[model samples]
Target chain A: MTWVTFLGNATDPKIGGIAFFGIFLSLVVFLIGQWLFKISNGFFLFQPLFVGMVLGIFILWLLSKWFGVALPTFYTAAYKPGGDILFWFLNPATIAFAVPLYRRNDVFKKFWLEIILSLVVGMVISLFAIYYISKGLGLNNDVISSMLPQAATTAIAMPISGAIGGTPAVTAMACILNAVLIYALADILIKVFRLNSDPVGAGLGLGTAGHTVGSAKAVQLGSVQGAMASIAVVVISIVVDVVVPPFAHMMGLF
Target chain B: MASNATQAKNQAPEHEPAPILQQMAIFASVLFVSSLISPLFPKSFPVPTPVIGLVLMYLLLATHIIKLYQIEKMADFLISLIAFLFVPSGVQMAASLNVFTEHGPMDGVMMIVTIILATIILLVVIAYTTACFMWVSRKLFHKSTDVE
Candidate 1:
């Protein structure tokens, strides 16, 4: 009915090239969200990624509700392929994290024991807490399994979730939500606990609970803290991957 | 003149700016190789392609097979844009709206609150425990240098 075909034609890929357009639009929306975040003086609630997600969702909703376009049509035409390509970058991006770890090799060597101990303890606490909380909440086993690996990065969490009979999408959501929570509240927790004095412990705690976004916060604290956070993300992720499956299986969780 | 010559000999070569194209190529090649190997393992395997890619890249850097300068720019660029890569996944949360609706908004709020509280408690406990360990180890080892 309308001439705004550039948005996408659900049936015709060649007419609109909506996959590429969707990515371009998502980036534009994200940049605007970033600008809003900056103007808000770095409010965590205004985090660009979260804002972008809300905006993207709203756009899809609008197309369906107001324009009379079906949801499935819009999804296949735009979101799926665009989202898949962007998601693919997550793999290489994870590998790139090693650069920071390599750059701070000295810190790793200097505080190896302390760092490893903190991560292991933190991870155990996280898994236990999730288990008890989910049980208390009366969540099903599948939901509990998905929520178990929320502390790890998405790249690592998804596989562990799958292996343990969890939903990958739910796991991804949990991981992102956890990161946002940590990013928003790291300072409050640090101040309340008097954690400012020990940067290595602080970084490890943040990364173990919060993952990459938490590491971003750690970077602001100092280089050693950032490096420690980077190491925690990788080490804790690997440890969780190895430990969660058999542990869950043994516990009859899977 | 002899001292000056010796100094010159000891100085390392000044690293030229790495070509962006080459750096990108190297980064892409490494990821490509990783993706190729990722599927060789069964789907049941918990280890993912990214972990393998990360290890491969780290080994290359540590072994001097790939200089930091060669991949530094591309790596940093990718890392800085890392948050962007998560946008689509975050947007996918839209699909879970049904879950929230089915459980009721109160339950959803309670779940989130519980998660946040648990995470904060976990963070504090871990930090304090680590500090205690460090202090105890320093005292036990009688190596003040070990604490820092």
Candidate 2:
């Protein structure tokens, strides 16, 4: 079929036209984001994924306007087909985390005690900190519940948030916000905190606070840092799995 | 001889990536098994399905059931796109923007500040504590465990 014919059929929910258009737009938007990132020399605001999502949403809104449909309906009919398919891969992508974790098992083996202990301690401290901080700021229980699991990566955090009566969408936004802030401010934080003395600690901090994006930055730092960051992601997720539920129950969040 | 095998394993990914078809088959099989296994976990603590898959993959690699070269390229490719895969969820934020603005702007600002402050605290605590512990342990037992 001609490209015009295919695109013209986008309004019909049953046809693959809108699905293909959604995928095409996502990729093109991603490429545009990458180009901006490259030109801006790695500015955090130009983060390709963030830029792509924002731009993609804006375009989807425009498409809805052009088609004279509500945003939600248009997104459900047109964009969600391809978007859901891309989201499905997040599961396998998460599993792919094992590659680096396996390669870096040596670090875990040697420093298991230190790594686990420090993370557990930090986890407890952060849990209390998040709880009190939110309460102090007069935020409601739902927001507090969402923030509680923010230390974990997005995949793991969302389920825990939902179980504990929190909004998974907000949980995701908090996760990405934490990641972007860490990615942008890591260098300065390291300098201020004197984290240069321990790459492993720095890496773990990045992964625990920032998730995969932080790990991406960790990879840029060095192999050891990359490995540690990967391990930290796994450990922190496991910790959140074990810890957040009980903590939430005790706090009456659930 | 043992060291030589280790060296070869380490160098494998640098040689060439696995073919696309092979990578797809591996990922498909892994996901299938993980889907079957994830439902077995208890309800109170719902460990994510992908995490179960992660553990499964780690075990396979650790026991040499799957070598690094077999899935290295595919893993890297997927991991790199992690940020991209998250975009849809991020875009969903557009729908929830009212959550922030429902209250006055000051309430929203406070919530943002709370999240940022809590994060900064988490970062500092984890980094410093981990570093201090590692340093202490190394000083006590200098058995060449230093990552540097």
Candidate 3:
């Protein structure tokens, strides 16, 4: 038993072959996504991350079938190595959010109580609404769990989702979905709600529901709304971090 | 108020972004130190290491122990790549493709409906609630001089 077997069966050349190929495959697919996103002029539908994931999975499936291997076996062998490494960076990325929160500390200082109070109320109400709606619709517990933390940006939301026994992948999709919905609806929502007079409230709402994408839309509305949205993204993430785990525990979701 | 914010931003001391290698080193050290500190907390209420790192980073910035210039570029870089970083986990969804089809298309449709409906309700509720609170706060805290 050589040291190589400790990692996996060393005698099998395919193991080493796939490892290098896996990293290359992930990078190439991601680069392709970036390219497509660029050419598409940053269209929401061509978002690089979303496009990369779908394309990567599709290509991996094709490779698995071509190689006469099981999908799980191929994935663990070929994609998981690079994929896992990429996923590990999510931790540091989560910490990077502190920068924006710090930069916009002024807005927070002025309306700290109002911002915190409103977000908490919104979060609590949203949680109850999501849980009961999912339950009433007879969605599975895993699906419900994923949907619970969709309000926060993906960096923060994914960890909380996993902690509370949700599927992080599903949570990721939900976060993106939430943002896209907000992007599409912001115009009509503003007009119907007559939010023209209150940019701060509008911004907070955008960031709370949409995360980054919503913030982008908020930016288009006005500078004040943009700043508010940015502030809301960080603050809501913090609120979700402190509040969701306990809430989930009490609800017996974990 | 918007002009006030721009004025505040202008008042901030201008600093060039840190050199790239130094930026990476600073980030790496923070991540390392944070991983070490996160375990000190009791297991009963688990806070993820990254969350702890966020607070630590905030304190460092607030105290000026670590200048914003040093990490701002790197931090922005990381935030931009969040989608790319999650590709691995998102791809894992491939493993569970059966989820959508296990109960047949009807169940899958129901699941989609549930997610969409819940998201819409949350969006509307949060927006109106936040706006309402802001309005009330302003009214309470800043009364008209006419009252006098």
The top-ranked prediction according to lDDT is 2
TM-scores (chain A) of the candidates: 0.83, 0.83, 0.64
Query: What lDDT tens digits, residue by residue, belong to model 1 across residues A34-61?
Result: 9989999987677787678778888777
| Order by DockQ, highest first | 2, 3, 1
- Highest TM-score among the candidates is held by which one? 2
* TM-score of predicted chain B, candidate 3: 0.73
Error of 1 at A210 (Å): 2.9
lDDT of each: 0.71, 0.77, 0.70
Model 1 lDDT tens row, B1-148: 3343233223324556489999878878888898888778765544567767777887786666877777777777877886677777666665565554456776666556666765776577667767876787689976452322
Global lDDT for candidate 3? 0.70
Task: List the DockQ of the predictions in order.
Answer: 0.39, 0.55, 0.42
- Please give the fraction of native interface contacts (Cα pairs under 8 Å between A and B) kept by each candidate: 0.52, 0.61, 0.52
* Local lDDT at A148 for model 3: 87
lDDT of 3 by residue, A101-210 (tens): 66665565577677778888888888988888888888777778877888876766787888899887778767765754565566776788776566667778877887
Interface RMSD of each: 5.2, 2.7, 4.9
Counting clashing residue pairs in each candidate, in order, gives 0, 0, 0
Better of 1 and 2 by TM-score: 2
Superposed model 1: Cα runs more than 4 Å off: A1-13, A69-73, A162-165, A249-254, B1-13, B40-44, B103-106, B118-122, B143-148
State which candidate has the highest DockQ: 2
